[model samples]
Target: MTTGRYLAAGLLAATALPSAASAGVTVTGVSGDPGFLTGRIIYTPGGIGGNAGTTSADLSIGRMKFTGFDTATAAALAFNTYCIDIFNYVQNGTFDLQTFTLGNAVKEEQLKALLSNTAGLIGGAATLGGKKDISAAIQLAVWEIVNESGNNGYSLSGGLFQVSATHGSAATNARALAQGYLNSLGGWSAQPGFNFSMLSAVSPANNQRQILFAPVPEPGTWALLIAGFGAVGGAMRRRTRTRLAYA
Candidate 1:
């Protein structure tokens, strides 16, 4: 059996974590219907495969082709897409065990609804006169909610859960869409509740390692970011930077 690992290249520009951060299910690969973004969280019942250290989840996006709008030009889009999130149940100092099972049917129902509402929503247009495929784009935004209260192998001990995601570039936008969905309910938030931590993208050679998407930004860097934002805004806006730090 092939153990597939996702490519961690490019940058995704989405909301930063509290300076911290963080799926697929298999009934033989669950796919969202055409024109809608579909996602599933599958459990092995005996826990996930591989290591005994930290348990991590991942979403895979296949390369897609797109075409320009007016000129009808076709081009392959290499988006730096990121911005999906996973949760471990340790919110604040207490143990929130909500990570075990997938949230009730409400979660699944809402996601399907999202796809329906966003139907026919294309990014811009594919170049080369070809239509753009957003299937991978949609998968990039899926998340895993392990154990309900969010505690897991890739998390800290006690009620201290973890969240992770890719930071910088197009990944950020993907993360934003996912965040909007999570925040819509009075349910999930990095502040006031769950703690977040961004995980370094696993090296491509080590396909055994699966990387989970989170809110972006390392846990310790949140306050620094706020200060940096203010400092630059008070004077002249600083130049934006890009990093291929997916690993």
Candidate 2:
């Protein structure tokens, strides 16, 4: 019986351990004068016991001039090859983040193509190809657009750009993606071609200031813990009762 109890306790403890896949997303690329920058933007999901994750990777771009189209929407509409979707919604729009999986391969491909085209047309060389796994898609979306220029930041042709992605709590994979990029860059900083922000708001969920990684413990976890303690208490109480009876 003691061995069985110990086994249960061990299992419960194992469940509480953080997984390698849940480490969160990170961005490592170049920006301003110093160029090289790496940071994490933490994220927390809503609802009781929801999962959390963070974006540690940071990038910045500035003074970008475009010639292909005026706005991201125009570029999308005009160039179907890239297939850019435009909207103004903050929570549930085309870019709204519902989960961390973001298992939309088609959308990912579209994003890559669009960014590549934008870079080429803007006369900016593709120093680093922006590629992210399914887990880091939301962070991928943020890096695709944001303010970074000292005087002028990353805004759409005519208006501010806002978009988000959603995924399940089980799919926190930002760390893996960031490591992939960093490996590709040979541990070098300052791409010398792009600009970056000062670790400001990276996600609409206010990811710039905190670490949004890892899910909350389930109610079952607490229940199991309480039940385990109750068992131990019951065992002690029975021993006391027997001693009193003997006396």
Candidate 3:
């Protein structure tokens, strides 16, 4: 078991931009416990289309074993750290926990209905030829609820998402569920979400756990991004003028 925390090199970047910020996940406080595995995973960001397509790629961190038994406080604190970072990057300020509410549980019936309505949704990948994959973006949202709510009810290992049916260990049953929906809809077509990233539990030793898919920021999020650039630029101009007057 590894114990030292190191940066997650080779992190996945759907698209890379010279100025684009790097992304990754690390879970703290829960260490060496079989129940929780949160480690740091980092990836570089670059793409041919610059940051535009990269923004479209959803952030999919692999499976988080949510059993709905969360104490809320610890989880909220942990999740908020990243939320604050993201908020600052987009909103130009620190994140307040009050702004984020705990989510409700997602029962099996509700999930089934969601899939039925969203059959065949898909999105283009950010890497390579911009490969298209089943983009059931909504499923990722539901996953978050299940995790936080502790609905350990149906899961990939044995629940609705069986590893064998998914065709590979590297995928979530949610992905398979998305693919199945596509098959019925005559294959993958344009969907609302893209660039979804997977989340995995990491051990303090830097070991990987099950993957959970996390949805990325939507276009509207970037639109809301508040920046200090304007203030800085104005201050710079004023300072320059003062220097010239003194000269």
TM-score, every prediction: 0.30, 0.18, 0.21
lDDT, model 1, position 243: 13
lDDT of 1 by residue, 1-247 (tens): 2322231211222222211111111011111112221122222221222222434333232221111111112211111222222221100010011121123454433333333333233333363111112433333323322223432222111222212335322234444444454444333322322222222222222111112222223542211000000000001112321111111
Against the reference, the lDDT scores of all candidates come to: 0.23, 0.19, 0.22
Candidate 3 on 43-157: residue-level lDDT in tens?
Answer: 1221201231221112322211111112223222121101101100111112111111123323333333333344323222353211112222233323322222244333333
What overall lDDT, based on C-alpha atoms, would model 3 receive against the true structure?
0.22
lDDT of the structure predicted as candidate 1:
0.23
lDDT of 2 by residue, 18-58 (tens): 12233221221101111111222221221101112321212
1 or 3: which has the higher TM-score? 1
Model 3 regions more than 4 Å off:
1-22, 28-186, 190-193, 200-247
Q: Give the TM-score of candidate 1.
A: 0.30
Candidates in descending lDDT order: 1, 3, 2
